[model samples]
Target: MPVLHALKRIGVLFLATAAILCTPGTPGAPAAADEPGWTAEPATGRAATARPYFYLEGTPGTVLEDRLALANTTDQERTVTLRGADAYNTAGGAFAVRPATESTGAGSWISFGAAGTVKVPPHTRAVVPFTATVPPASPPGDHPAAVVATEGGREVGVRVHLRVSGPTLAALTVEDVAVRGKGAGTVVAYTLVNRGNVALAPELALRAEGRFGEVPGRGARALPVELLPGQRVELTEPWPGAPVFDKVDLALTVTAPGGARATAAASAWFVPWAIAARTGAGLLALGAVALAALFLVRTRRARREPPPDGAPVPERAGQTAPEHELTGTSR
Candidate 1:
């Protein structure tokens, strides 16, 4: 029995050594159905075969157990390294496993009975036992992780979904909302932050009002985002045919699962300077023309009307009036 245990340990070491020694092949290439290779799957149990993921619901201070199956489909011996990593959704919304160097949350809470490595003979499989212990301080809601097998710089993983039972809160907020660009081509940008312990798929509604009245509002649109707890993302929406001149008031409303609602508002002024300048110049020209016409009419009226009766008549240089000659006694 001692010799058998030694042999098993040796097999595990060999698996670990192979993972480090082998050169990496092409990254993310799927093996053909008929090709000889290896695969990692969930062990046969409650929902392993159909779901292929460890889904356990437990409260804080609870312990759950599971198993993973590693298979070698080739005619030669295969070795690999077993590890655990946190799981997250990529930008494209695909489920992804974290790098081997990092582990947190559920990944750190899980432990395996087998060593870091395992060896499987040709056309054979190995089953490894593992356990997940929820900490007393862990928050409520879903925690996603994965168990992976690495060989020759390639990895295959199976998901581990651990849910800590408690009140699930879906709180979110809209922040830093603003409008960008001008005229008919404009966009509204904002940040969406998850403030609770549950994931959310949010729907957004954008409305804008000008000095005159409400402009065309963009109806609610569902965003293609799987927002995780404590994560924030910046996003933008098109505001086609935006008002060109006015004080615009913008508002954004976001709603998600569990009746989560948040709203943010911003104000901006849009003025077409070129058009305003032209309109002011036209008004000034019209005022000048009206003033000139008034002046001309007043001058013409003074010339056409007779002057007030004069107190004295004017005298010529060589011919003076009789009254002036008699008073001066000289011409």
Candidate 2:
């Protein structure tokens, strides 16, 4: 089979295996509500914008995972209270299936920090972490949920969504992910590590996978990489555009080195932030030093001998004042 086709087949099998591994009601199944919260402006009080964009997923009947962040851009200090966790089914369309108050915020199914009122100071943000699982008979599609916040009697909220596209036939894993920042942009490097116990080859491709970044493979180098169980190699992915985040995950696909088996991939984190921040700070320091040096030179010059423009008046050191000639001439 052609490399691409083989990879497609491998991906299909991987999903199939995942679906099988994740029965509809396995304790670890994807939660009835996978993701919870609006991506951007959760309410009209503010525009749509998730400070730290988030997404979640898990096997059917398995554990759910989540990460939520809130940013403060308002002018005044406010108190944020969380409530109203509602779940929904988005398979056919928008449909509410569960309430925010159900389930205990409970168990590993719904992990929350302190379910009560949490103070969010001005100009700061916070995160709410959670998890969930699907019931055995829940029909598959997209499931969603939300966490609401109330302040000054006004409410702001966010939503999360999860897609139950069935299960995986094989365990698909990715590795060696890395990123480097270029002014307003970044460079990512990574390699695929195939850990499945199958002699496989798959095709690899990537798309928008991180918080906010663009990937261009032109100068991107996909190495003559091959993978075996426990095998890995480094590959460099070029990101030519500015990303909106310090770190983010991406989505893509890859075949085994032989290009026989292919698997679809969701991204992990790509962090190019620390270096960028350091580089920016370093440049700023250099500029400050240069300015300081210039100032010092000017100060020293001003205190030292004056320039030609400020030359001293010449004078005869020993000449006595010339006696005034008193001859009065008639004009």
Candidate 1: tens digits of C-alpha lDDT, residues 102-129:
6776777877755568888999988787
131-211, model 2: which lDDT tens digit per residue?
556555544433444444455533433433443445322233555565555644565565555454332344556566344
TM-score of 2: 0.29
Residue 115 of model 1, lDDT score:
59
Query: What TM-score does model 1 achieve against the real structure?
Result: 0.62
> How much does each candidate deviate from the true structure in C-alpha RMSD?
10.6, 22.2
Give the least accurate 10-residue stretch of model 2, judged by summed lDDT: 12-21
- Shift of residue 302 alpha carbon in model 1, Å: 21
Q: TM-scores of the models, in the given order?
A: 0.62, 0.29
In terms of lDDT, model 1 sits at 0.69
Lowest lDDT sum, 10 consecutive residues, model 1, at 1-10
Model 1's C-alpha root-mean-square deviation from the true structure amounts to: 10.6
| Candidate 1, superposed: residue stretches over 4 Å from native | 1-49, 69-78, 87-102, 120-128, 156-158, 182-185, 244-246, 270-331
User: Which one is best on lDDT?
Assistant: 1
